[model samples]
Target: MKLKVIGIIAILLVVVGASCQSDDQIEFKRYYSGGSLVYQQHCQNCHGDKGQGLSALIPPLTDSIYLKNNKRKLACFIKNGLKGKITVAGRSFDDQMQPDDIAPLEIAKVLTYVTNSFGNNMGTVTLQQVQDDLNNCQ
Candidate 1:
């Protein structure tokens, strides 16, 4: 009887594990696809498809220190465009970053991609966060 109970528990665990990939994960998959398209069109030319920087001109987003340390700054800087001096991952970037062209929703999607891809582990940037920052800027 104990052996049977153990077998049942094992089956239950397997069932639970199989169902762990839920609808939310599907949504994330979609978001990642959309963000990939956007990045390919806009960012890949300079940042490379894998988020690696173009030497001293463009900075790599694959570094976790830059993403995790300046997550909010990255979002805001992308939205508003950066000018003058800025530092990330013990390096300084002084170029002007063009403001994001897409809407708040699209911007959030792309940012989510950057935050989750390469070597980054940051969370998604919400549409509300983009909209609010844009409003505050103007």
Candidate 2:
């Protein structure tokens, strides 16, 4: 009887662990999965499907150390665009980001996707954080 009880407890623990994982997966899908679509529509054309960036003209956003330090600037830069010069991975990109005017929520989604993908693990970019960042920019 004791052996049977131990087996039942082990099965229960497995089921509970699986349930917790599903919840995390749902949250991951809500942000990263949705953000991917936003990225494809707005950023993929220039930044490449994998954020590899175009040569001479555009700079890659993937695994960007500049981005890690200036996370707040991303939303503003993405929306209002970046002109002049910027450095990433020791390379200089002197060009235009071309102001996109994407919505605040879209910016958050894009940032979340960019900062979390492409060898980046900057974590989720919340809507409120984007709004605050944009407000501070101006």
Candidate 3:
């Protein structure tokens, strides 16, 4: 009886531990899922359903290097819009991206989704980070 009880407790512990997600993981999932919705509503029109931006017009989101290098500026770009010339995927794009007047939290969520989707793996772009970046926007 004692051995059986110990085994049951061990099994329960394993199950519980396995099912538990770290705070970061939980937050990532929340942001990613919420961002998905935000993307569909706001970004899908220009960026496309697969993030493959319009040819030579809108820059695609699949450029991991650009995303990583400009990770901090992304929040500002989203909130304030982008214009002029920029290079993505070794191609130069001179176009205008209208500003999205979304809340900082929504920016964070959508950024989290964009940075992690379309062959990107930039992890989570937290709300705090987005707010900080927005404050420093040029």
If the candidates were sorted by their lDDT against the true structure, best first, what order would they fall in? 3, 2, 1
lDDT tens digits, residues 1-138, model 3?
999999999999999997798999999999999999999999999999999999999999999999989988999898889999999999999999999899999999999999999989989999889989998999
| Candidate with the greatest lDDT versus the true structure | 3
lDDT at position 49, candidate 1: 84
- Candidate 2: residue pairs that collide: none
Model 1 stretches astray by more than 4 angstroms:
1-20
Better of 1 and 2 by lDDT: 2
Task: Supply candidate 1's per-residue lDDT for 119.
Answer: 78
Scored by CA lDDT, what does every candidate get? Answer: 0.76, 0.85, 0.93
What lDDT is reached at residue 76 by model 1?
Answer: 68
Q: Which stretches of candidate 2 lie over 4 Å from their true place?
A: 1-15, 21-28
Clashing pairs in 1: none
What is the C-alpha RMSD, rounded to one decimal, of candidate 1?
4.3
lDDT per residue, candidate 1, 63-125, as tens digits?
A: 787677665566567667778876665688888788765777777778889888987866667
- TM-scores of the candidates in the order shown: 0.74, 0.82, 0.88
